[model samples]
Target: MSNDTAAQPAYFIAHITVDDVEGYRNYEKGFFPVLKPSGARFVTYDDNVTVLEGERESGRTIMIEFPSEEALMTWWDSPEYRELAKVRQAAVTTHSVTIVHSLPPR
Candidate 1:
């Protein structure tokens, strides 16, 4: 495959605080299925407990790798996923989403 075709271009990290743990668990369980149709994949979907920090945080951290910026946007705007996002917005009090480009092949 050509580099353009084979290369996945973006990494996204999310720092989140869930207001309702039960609701967040339900939301987490539902995310992958919605994302699968858009061809997004997770590099890490770690909960806060395993994270080492000065203080324990009450939230979740997620990292996802998308095939491209376009792919990431596609997933974000997808009807299926967008609809489900309400669960997250309602449950999460504070959150951050960051996207960074991957280093291209030398």
Candidate 2:
């Protein structure tokens, strides 16, 4: 199966709380290269987040859209991302990553 082909579109969403701001910056810088080959596009990155309801709140919210689940997984499991994840792990105190599928266009 090709990287671009999948049953549906997939999105990666992350809610993060950074413990080391400077270290997080470094992680952001290193992330671009890791994302480039994965064909993932940034949907949003908001540091100033407002919690409307839930008990859980994060310092930042990020969303990335991918062509397919396969491509998303390929990127997530790739060596480049694995190495970069170390930087993210060190910088953030807490985070949640989720994968969601998009509904087909009408």
Candidate 3:
């Protein structure tokens, strides 16, 4: 068969750090459902990492993948989610939400 994965949807990765793991976990529990309505999914929320050439860490990291740019924007712009953003901001010291198209398909 020919390659069928060419038609799959892409993703946006959010490489972030949280100062308080407990607070972040609470935020995730609360906000995760909010994101699902906008087609956001947690591909990997890994805490274990090896920092080779980056700032020293004291917070947790997150990686979220959206289906597409439009979908990511949908969640980002949604009023419902916007209101809840403070929870995340307070929970984490800093966060870098980056959007990149997923390679191939997932």
Candidate 4:
């Protein structure tokens, strides 16, 4: 999809500090089913994260790549995800959730 960057890909970043394993598991159990329809790609998650520069809020990092910002938002804003997010909210301290766009095609 076109944007100010003219068709740049979008990525979602989640900085989370999980508090209740069972609660996060509850959220994780349903994550893929909701994520599947959006065509979002799970990049990876890092539990051993290091901050090279500025300080960060959490130690766990999760990333997902999407074809476009619209696709990412569509999945993120859906009722299923909204409901599931509550489970995550109860389980973790989410430092930040950010959407970033890649550089436009070179």
Q: Highest lDDT, which number?
A: 4
Which candidate should be chosen as best, given TM-score against the real structure? 4
Candidate 1, after superposition: displacement of residue 36 in Å? 0.8
lDDT tens string, model 1, 1-106? 3566446578778878878889888888999898887667788766645645566456777888888877888888888778888898888965678888876666
Each model's lDDT? 0.78, 0.86, 0.67, 0.88
Q: Tell me the TM-score of model 3.
A: 0.69
Write model 4 residue lDDT over 1-106, tens digit each, in one string.
4465534569999999999999999999999999999988999999988789988775699999997888888999999999999999999999999999887766
Off by over 4 Å in 4: 1-7
Which 10 consecutive positions of candidate 3 have the poorest summed lDDT? 1-10
Question: Which sections of candidate 2 miss by over 4 Å?
Answer: 1-7, 104-106
Residue-level lDDT of model 2, residues 44-71, one tens digit each, is: 9898777787777658889999878988
lDDT leaderboard ranking: 4, 2, 1, 3
lDDT tens digits by residue: candidate 3, 58-93: 544566776666677778888878877777787776
Off by over 4 Å in 3: 1-10, 52-56, 103-106
Question: How well does candidate 4 score on lDDT at residue 61?
Answer: 96
Q: Flag the better candidate by lDDT, 1 or 2.
A: 2
How many angstroms is residue 87 displaced in model 1 relative to the true structure, after the best TM-score fit?
0.6
